[model samples]
Target: MSTFKAPKGTYDLIPPVSETFLAVREALAAPLRRAGYGYVETPGFESVELFARGVGESTDIVTKEMYAFTTKGGDELALRPEGTASVLRAALEANLHKAGNLPVKLWYSGSYYRYERPQKGRYRHFSQVGAEAIGAEDPALDAELIILAVDAYKSLGLRTFRLLLNSLGDKECRPVYRAALQDFLRGLDLDDDTRRRIDINPLRVLDDKREAVQKQLTGAPMMRDHLCEACKTYHEQVRELLTAAGVEFEDDPKLVRGLDYYTRTTFEFVHDGLGSQSAVGGGGRYDGLSEMIGGPELPSVGWALGVDRTVLALEAEGVELHVPASTQVFTVALGEEARRTLFGVVTELRRAGVPTDFAFGGKGLKNAMKSANRSGARYAIVAGERDLAEGGVQLKDLQSGEQAPVALGEIVAELRRKLV
Candidate 1:
């Protein structure tokens, strides 16, 4: 082992495990693609003020968790702690909302960075597959995002996860509820940080998970009670649409996600199996976020499913994803001439859309065959000087231990036929 390692609270996705991560990402993005969401990519870092203004100054993600730094050029930047703020900034900068679409749907997959004490389901650096529908305030858009998340999880064969839904109410009614919640929080015994949060973002105080804080919040005010007529109707429509689509969700009155931008409809996906970090992924409406970040009013609803947590959920429930073998065929060349010839064969097979690998480093027949066997390849192509002299190669079925001779020209076609 080298003296160096991945930075504390970070990890490298390598080998067989990395394959599962890719599969999980694909599963999460599939629903978005089917729903007309186009792919989008953004830089790993952005202006620190972008997140400070968009993610909110009072949130822990901004106040403590964000990995912020100043560059040599005197630019303040931070590795993105979340997806929505960065994505929205990119969309607005590129004028995507002006492209004659009511809701500019986009899907993205990438890593996010934060400074945090790492845990099983939580990491300082993690991967997420997120979808956003910008410039739309419709309930169907909110419901559509939730349903898409549900479909993605189910697609990965996850059954035990539950969707916790809530409506934080819009600007018209949130202040009234905020004042009520703040008053209730003031009467409770709490730490300085918790007390300060009551004033800055009182709703987040209700989200506190500490046993002491949670006990004091027993009868705290709920957003559902303070929602105005418009918000109530909108929330009801979202719930009704979800129910109509056969998606079951529990009404979580306190599901104020750990973000300040969310408004009206809010939700979280949780798996009880992930103790202490039960939330797998979640997001909600952020209607005023655009204005907060110096852009026009573009109400948006989105969710990011954590790839790391989803993989953990799968392991907890023992749901193994179906990842096909990476190498379908492994080739073993016996001699120098055989090496050049078989290398050509490997290239040909790969160009023909066959997953092929060649035994390198000039290993002898026995060692090369061992490498081929370890490759998990279904078939092994063995060619020696004698076999080449016969203008053919030996194709051995790795599974059945059967060998047959095939003409050099027909090898690609024969393998494709066998694979099919």
Candidate 2:
């Protein structure tokens, strides 16, 4: 046996399974593209401070899960644990916000790293499909992002996931709400770590999944009740837009997302059937993220859906993503003379936009046809020494089990006319 593997907490995506991943990415990004979001690609790793500031130092992403290391140049860098921060950093560095576009719309598909205890849907390394609309504070943008996500899921035939919505309130009201939350948290019997969370980011305490912490938090102060007038209006407008658009959502006061930068609007998508790791994806408005990362004050909203988790959710609901079959034609040749001649014809067929494949081994005609059948090819092109000598070949329709002898010079046009 080989002494190497894909490393713990990480899995290889191969073949048919990879097709599912591609399908999910396409389903999610298709709507974003239509909505004016151009594709963006950022490096897999960035300076550690980018996330520390953009994602919030107090959050588990930075404090615990991030895979950070000092490079040979003494620069601290981390593989992105999430997509939004790096995308935001790229936007900031490129002066995308200053490009006069009110919202620099972009979509990305990539992998993320986190030192998590490996589980069904959670991994030390995972893939994500995220979208960001930067430089905007409009409630419609918030609602639009959410609607895009919902549409993406629906288009993928997913039905088991539920949308969770919340507002953390803007800067004007969040401080007051944090103070109230702190007062309540301090009174609870919490561990040292929980207490530290109170000082660094009291809102994160609301994200505690422990039974005891959740019980103690049942009567805690709610941020929604303390929202400032402006935040309340913004949140309300977001809700109104979603409602008017007929997007279903549940208002969750406890959805104070784990990230520290999220302000005003926070949301999560959960699959009820996924057991403990039910959150398939989520994101929110991070109005202070730019300033936190030492950039100008630019508000941004976005979401990252777990491609793995989404695939699991689809599986849980028995939703099969229909990945189209690999190609239309398979070419089979017998003897060296025929093989050489057919190889050129195969190349020409492919160049002419035909999805074609050819047998590699010098197999007998029967075995070649068998290979063609296994390849899911709709048609098979067979050429033997005799056919090569006669200036023609045979075309067989695998579906109809019918064959026709055609002139060699006319095969390409015949295939094109029949296949198209």
Candidate 3:
């Protein structure tokens, strides 16, 4: 092993297992693609202020978990701890919303960084597939995103996960709820740090998971109770739409999420089997985020499904993803001349859209066949000097142990036929 390892809270995605992660990401993004959401990519790091202001400075993600640093140029930068803020910043900077589109739909898949005490289902470096609908505030837009997420999870055969939903009243009524929540939180026996959170963002204090904190928060005011008539109607419409579409969700009164940007509709996808870190993915509306980062007012809604956590959820439910074999056909060449000829054949097979691999380093037939077996390929082509002289190559079906021969020029066509 090399003397170095992936940084303490990070991981390497190796084969077999890595294939599952890829499948999970593709599954999550498929619905977004079909929904007219274009792909978006952002830098791994951005100005620290973008997050401090957009993600809410009082949130743990900004103050404690953010991987922030001051560059040699005296510029402060931080590896993104989440996707929403960075994505919105990019959309605003590029003026995508001004392109005559009411909601610029975009989807993204990448790794996000955070500084946290890593544990099962929680890591400093993790993968996520996110979607954002910028410049819209309709409840149907929120319902649409939720439906798309549910479809993605269902497409992966995940059934035990639950969608927990809540509405964190928008600017009109959030202030009223915030004050009420802060008043209730202050009466609890909280630490100095948590007490300070009461002043900055008391909703975050309600997200506290500590047993001592939980015990004291029994009577805390819920956002549902404080929602204004507009927010209440909007929340009800979202719920009604989700139900009409057959997406079942439990109404969570205190689902504030970890970020401070979330306003109005907040939700989380949780798998009961995931233990303490049950949230596989979640996101919600951030109506004021655009203005928070010095952009025009653009109400947006989005969700990011955790690729790592989704894989864990799959395993927890004992669901097997149908990851296709990387190599569909393996070629074993005997002699140097046979290697050259078979190498050309391999290239031809690949050009013909066959997933083919060749045995390199000139191993003996036995070792080469062993490699072919381990490749998970359905078929193997073996060519020796004698076989090449005869103008044919031996073809073996790895699954049934059937062997035959096909003309050298016809091998690619033969494999393609059998594969189909």
Please provide, for model 1 over 1-420, each residue's C-alpha lDDT reduced to its tens digit, 9 standing for 90 to 100: 798999988999998999999999999999999999999999999999999999989999999999999999999999999999999999999999998877999999999999999988788999999999999989999999999999999999999999999999988999999999888889999999988898899989888888888887888889999999999999999999999999999999998989999999999999999998999999999999999999999999999999999999999999999999999999999999999999999999999999999999999889989998999999999999999999999999999999999999999999999999
Would you estimate the TM-scores of all the predictions? Answer: 0.99, 0.97, 0.99
Model 1: how large is the Cα RMSD against the reference? 0.7
Question: What is the C-alpha lDDT profile of model 3 across 92-196, one tens digit per residue?
Answer: 888999998789999999999999999999999999999999999999999999999999999999999999999999888999888888888888888999999
Where does candidate 2 stray beyond 4 Å?
none
- Score residue 172 of candidate 1 by CA lDDT: 94
Error of 2 at 60 (Å): 1.3
185, model 2: CA deviation in Å?
A: 1.2
lDDT of each: 0.94, 0.91, 0.93
TM-score: model 3 vs. ground truth = 0.99
Cα shift from native, residue 244, model 2 (Å)? 1.2
* Leading candidate by lDDT: 1
Q: Any runs in candidate 3 off by more than 4 Å, and if so which? A: none
Give the local distance difference test score of model 2. Answer: 0.91
lDDT of 2 by residue, 270-377 (tens): 999899999999999998888888888888899998899999999999988888767788999988988899999999999999988999878887888888999888
How many clashes in each structure? 0, 0, 0
Deviation in Å, model 3, residue 185 alpha carbon: 1.6
